[model samples]
Target: MTTTETPGADTVRPRWGAERIGNAIFAAVVFGLGVFALVGAFAIRVPAGQAIGPQVFPFAVAVILLGSGAALVISALRGQVAPREEGEDIDPDAKTDWWTILKLVALLVAVLLLLELLGWWMVAALLFGGVAWTLGAKRPWVAFLVGLVIGIGTQLLFGEGLGLFLPRGAAFDWWYGPGPLFG
Candidate 1:
């Protein structure tokens, strides 16, 4: 018999039981939701004179989710744990860089504040630039331009063309005449 020696072999150990238990619990919760959805589909009445109602689609989705969740639970019970190719124990409370989160939150807040003052185009542009910069973007001006295009483009297409009443900001009044649009 031949044995191969590996450097730093003493540090490697199998994952703890808690991770497996946590995963099992998550699987169980998903399974329970699936069951709930499946049951809910039958609890509601289908409207008369409708060939395909809401109940049918929800029921089909629920059944599919139920089957998949059941399969996952069964696989977990059969000792088929998720493979940890990286050899690191999955810790839920692990530290992640919060800069992106802060940036996104700031963006949301800025958007809300600037919506009435600067309008969707300017607000979205500012938010996108800020977020991109915070997330290590090298060119924030590009992000700003992209954000402006996307924000105003959506409004023009959905709100103006399709006649959807998306919320407009005070800047809309300043840029164009009264009553919500440029047309």
Candidate 2:
């Protein structure tokens, strides 16, 4: 068949071309997560006590995700998304920078691992500077300063102001002692 006489020639054109594929993928993931969460709830026992249990929140969130995922998938398949009007000022470079984002995520995971061995201040500092540097921050000193400040500041805020505990790191354990706060 010619391009002009294609099978879907009479249908309305989708306003957002990329959104169709994106929404379908998003829907599948959300639906899968919802199903998993709902299934996980079965492993927990209610214990016949309070109005709700730990499984309640997960179950509810799962249901909502499932419903929304279904709707998004259906809308995407039907091409029912509204089109952007003509001459709209859309940013051409608004797409996801996967490599940068992945680097940042890797930095975050490293920070989490380092937190147990390096302490709150040290890990926080590293996390801050590392993430920034990984994401192409040019100023190393600035990133370091920012990381240090954030790490120490958050440590003080959570440990002192909020009275929440923080790990003192493995170094602290070897130097001072081992405890829940220090461990």
Candidate 3:
């Protein structure tokens, strides 16, 4: 196939634009991750006399990551990159809402810390409510109620129905008693 090139396209170094630099950095990260995965997979122990050991999946994953990362790095180095998004992109001139971002991040950290003590249900509810409130929900109380329902429902579904080990609240042991509710 005939390949067409613009004037000076055969230059040794492609233009070091922001997009190209970002793409190259991302590609390098992926390549580094692939190397890490491959090395970790080699460290995995294979059980004796097993037809398909645990290492099989890890090795397969490593190969896929390595191949994809190598391809990305090559494409990036060649200055063949892709746009992040297609249509309806965010306005470039618009200022970032740092307050909202900070609140949401704080909420996430709080949830992570309180997950064990307050339980998944309470943490999930708080997280949902906090996020909704931060995002300017019309009714914050209603959002909290909805969050509560969601938390209980998810706990019942994943914890009770699916038999997953979801906490029943360490702080509120009186509410859950000995075993999980409906478990």
Q: What is the C-alpha lDDT of each candidate?
A: 0.75, 0.76, 0.82
Q: Which stretches of model 1 miss by more than 4 angstroms?
A: 1-94, 179-183
| Alpha carbon deviation, residue 171, candidate 1 (Å) | 3.6
TM-score of each: 0.50, 0.54, 0.60
Q: For model 3, how does the per-residue alpha-carbon lDDT over 19-116 read when each residue is reduced to its tens digit? A: 78888888888888888888998897776898986677778888888888889889888887575554577665566799999999999999888988
Model 2, runs deviating above 4 Å: 1-18, 27-98, 174-183
Candidate 1 local lDDT, 94-135, one digit each (tens): 666787787789788878877777766677678877888888
Give the TM-score (vs. native) of candidate 2: 0.54
CA displacement after TM-score superposition, residue 46 of candidate 2 (Å) = 16
RMSD of each: 9.0, 7.5, 5.7
Ranking by lDDT: 3, 2, 1
Score residue 34 of candidate 3 by CA lDDT. 81
